[model samples]
Target chain A: MGRIKLMGLAVSIGKVTERYPFAPVEVPDDYRGKPVIDPGICTGCGACASACPPQAIQVKEEGEFRVVHLFLGRCIFCGRCQDVCPEGAIRLTTEFELATPNHDDLHQFVRLRMVRCVRCGRPFDTYRHLVRSLREVPFIEGERLLLCPECRAKAPLDWLEGGGDGNEG
Target chain B: MGRSTLEGRFRVIDVSPDEVAEVVRELFEDGCYYATGMGVDERPLNGRFAVYHAINCPKRGVYVILRLTAPENRPSVPSITPVLRGAEWAEREAHDMVGVTFENHPNLERLILPEDWPDGVYPLRKDFPYNRKMAGTEGTAGVRGERHDEATMSVPLGPYHPLLHEPEYFELYVREDRIVGADYRGFHVHRGMEKLAESRMTLNQIPFLAERICGICGCTHSAAYCQAVEEAAGVEVPERALYIRSLMLEVERIHSHLLWFGVACHLLGFDSGFMHFWRAREYVMDIAELITGNRKTYGINLVGGVRRDLSGEKIQKTLKLLELAEGESREVIDNVVGMKELIARMEGVGVLRRKDAREIGVVGPVARASGIDTDVRRDHPYAAYGDLDFKVPVYRGCDVLSRFLVRVDETFESFSLVRQILENLPDGEIINEEYSLPYMEFGLGSTEAPRGEDVHMVLTGGENQVYRWHPRAPTYNNLPAVPLMLEGEDVADAPIIIASIDPCFSCTDHVSIVDAGSGRVLWRGPLLEGVERLRR
Candidate 1:
């Protein structure tokens, strides 16, 4: 009798398994899958790199550009990079079919052009990052923003005291 | 008292090495049980190595932690295995991981590390690098089979068996069809997570690392770890966050229990029941994915609170799914209980008496099944468990049937608890990001995992890192009782008896039997097949 009832229940529940490769399964809207970075809005500040638990996201300086690399192989899909992104650039999409034969396919690199300091002639900050900073602090001169943080700090006090020109310095 | 946390719910006491046994014994006499013990290399902090024993005192509703520090030059402490048998594995683990000597500990050999691992180099020490790789010593690997008496035949269950989900070795000494003695050597999948958490992972990042401890009950570990850090840092998590946490934990419990039921049914040769139980479990998984964005490893827990919030729509959907899950789970479990043949297989088999249960310090369904009324959720409530009303179902049968029945009842209880949490969820912020980390402050966080009580101990270090983080999975406490359960039982029932405790080995690995007297391989195949051959 119990077996009869179990058979009835099984008949009612029929099949729960899905044909994954043959059929497309719909994931929820908030499904945490592979995280991708929107290069246009990314400021190359390395917040995601620091916030990532597995150190999957790495930021490195390569001569003229600051490259933010997100390796899919090491990613735990924790979606922490999305949480800590100041610019809301990194987003976790519902695309989780991330298998690949080529090793390079796992790497997602976003390269931002680095701006050289006017005085020191060394790349310091990304151009977009400096521009974004300029928007927040409008009182600071654009020329002052052009100089790297080190060059700006080392500059004399008279340069800031002067109203418009460098003549006073 | 050294320090207290969570409104004096957890108290730390400093004790000298000689008094360790006496103090633990006194606590045991006062109705306390050994939760877990850890050895920490505290030379960077106090120029001494420390050993902490966390004892759960249920009557007082407080966790009493006894701390004993040994000087760096001679790091040794009196072993508490004399007072409590449950402390044996933990003491041996401490010795293996941190190079701390447990004086007078019977059979204090290497427990966690492999035999090939080089001696005198402790991985958990401050001087050791997290990513450092050591060369495996020559010719130290392979089986060190202990020969039993000629009367009893030695049958090995695992290092990998199809019956087991993970890699574990159990040598059962059988006399014809009945078993006399058993021995276990596990920890094949130990990933050195504590070392990684202390060295590389920061405060918030360790939650994800903790979640990876067990694939089935990862959220519980993460929740325990987060609670430990929150207690250490004195972070006040919002009320609504607590409710959501409780909701997710209950969801995890329901799914985990269902999974275990399916496994048990499979072991009992009831494959149809296994399929049905897992089919019902899909609803709970769907609910989890809808809320936490994943079926397992919810990844919702953070240090201050949770990362995700439950919306009204999501809550309604979750409730609908919960209804379906509850109904189907009830239908399946009720059918399973009514089957007399299945009941016969489980009943009067794998008997672990109440006294043995308490002495071994088992927790969760196994302890409850054995008449030990202990649940960390009720005793020392963390998250929203304090606000929720639930009955801890216990059975005195002290057999495999009791364990199954306990889980069945607990599954229904979890369903009701989830409903309560979802309905009464407080409306406010989900996270409280404002908190400060106190350096070198000890905190203990415990959660009643599906298997048993999962404990995580944390010592907050400067620069957003834990100085020493030790997580004791429920299996660590419960695995010791398997040999006792296997003794004097039918050798064919060995797989079900071992599976009855819900040993979550966290990795897959294989088993063979060797002749004890002749030192020859008797059988080398799946444990079930070996059992069949032995029966014939």
Candidate 2:
């Protein structure tokens, strides 16, 4: 019950604090920073896609190929996307410095990749490898297919005409 | 004794594990919700496995726990997951720890252990040796296992990694920063509480183990565990102990919410808010340390009664402190809520639709944010919450911001609740004389921890030792949502987004994510392997 308002007295009860902007605040050793993507090794499995609550990364796996398209604007920078990531392809960069003139520019990332297929413009993938030995959906044209390089070259018009990204019509 | 008035709604019907499916289905027909169930390890004694199923009827507002026991020779039962979706992880935990095989459980893969774990060595079974083995050398020690898909990649998160204070490892499937898939393996800080409780500790000594389970939610865990022991041991807490227990629970709520606010600020790149909230948090910590000897771990909870007393002076101090926190924290929280840019960034970002929250059974603020109204404190009140006046803060935004808002609002509500309890502080002996120790009994205790509902299932052996103690923290139930929520999100939002759920990494470990049962890494060698070949 022995307390008084600090403002009433000339001497403050506590030390005066310094401004953060005028000084470089010390970052902890374990500070979570920017995200880094390894283009060469990224599998585009979309665990980052799933782990990321923000839906910031678009990973399309049509067949053998996987495409990883990361947009940073939607990022909460939680590091679960990084932690849950099975491969070390994605690393949170030490740079947390993110700012941009345009909203879209804030979506910049360190990398993007297309795996397995070509003509469909999705990730490159082989259907046989995707569904190995599992006899579920049969018939090539009856079901959909990921266009390999040769198939894309053979029927460029047909592949490009009605072709949409996988999971798309 | 307060008899459950909802007895007409939920009559305790004894059902076997096999009958659990049919019994629970019938309950669902009666409009009962599947609250929670647990798998317990009962080995050496009868060499049997036990699984408990619980159901709740909101109209009646009561809960019932049903027990299932299977002999250790072939511990298997019909799966209830098909009937109740929430049963999936519970069954997996049963299989992972207690070694109960849920028959017809689709995707019956190990949910915690890595693929390479030595076969048939269940950890929680009472007879599993209590000594530590080699860490990295023995396959029994580490969670990593063989893989399939020919694309094996090991991405460790922590024992000391950036972006996390807890130690855990998540193996990743990567073509790049976009993690195609992952396996979460934790237990980096396995304090060996279970072994210590059963083998080394007595009935009186086990509450310390409960307190050590989590520093922040000490009262909740210890309270639940102790209540279970008290119920099993036939010990009755006095009405005054019950009221004081409720008071501590609300104080814990305030403390947890404040800590969460600080963590949330730290995640959103708001340093000032983080510092200010933590500074505010120091007051509550001071209050707790004053009441319970420890600063972080408050060991005030005891079975059948409280270890300390709350006099008029202590109650007045607590009331004044709550009032002080409420006045100061309101302005700071309002300023935080008014951070338009930060709020906008979190709004509608990281949405876990209501359907997924229920379907996957995400608990606490995460589920409440998504409009899933399931709180143990509210649905089935145990403490003063049953008697107190408070509203469950909920929002339908289902985003990171809504989660933040829920905690912030809940903080103020908790502060007010604390004041109300302190002002009307009941006076009586904190301990009940008749309930010091009765006989063998088992009780299920639930307290909403800082993160979510912490459920502790306990079976006691009267005065000798605890038969079994299973503490299922809210984080255990919420872990499955990570893979579901992380889908289609950017690599950048990894930190703040993961922090949004207010994750308790200590509670969960890696469950294997083998590519179609194949344990092969398709694309191996160094980073230069494929790239160098392409260049050549």
Best candidate, DockQ: 1
List, residue by residue over B89-153, the lDDT tens digit for candidate 2. 77876787678888989767676555555667776777676674524325444433334244433
The candidate that wins on TM-score is 1
TM-score, predicted candidate 2 vs. hidden true structure: 0.67
> Lowest-lDDT window of 10 residues in candidate 2 chain A?
A1-10
Off by over 4 Å in 1: A141-144, A149-153, A159-169, B1-5, B139-147, B507-536
TM-score of chain A, model number 1: 0.88
Model 2 chain B worst lDDT window (10 residues): B510-519
Candidate with top lDDT is: 1
The fraction of reference interface contacts (C-alpha pairs within 8 A across chains A and B) present in each candidate is: 0.72, 0.00
TM-score of chain B of each: 0.93, 0.84
Chain A vs native chain A, TM-score per candidate: 0.88, 0.52
- Which of the CAPRI classes, incorrect, acceptable, medium or high, describes model 2? incorrect
Docking class of 1: medium
lDDT of 1 by residue, B202-302 (tens): 99999998887877788898999988988888788888888888888889999889988988888888878988988889899899999999888899999
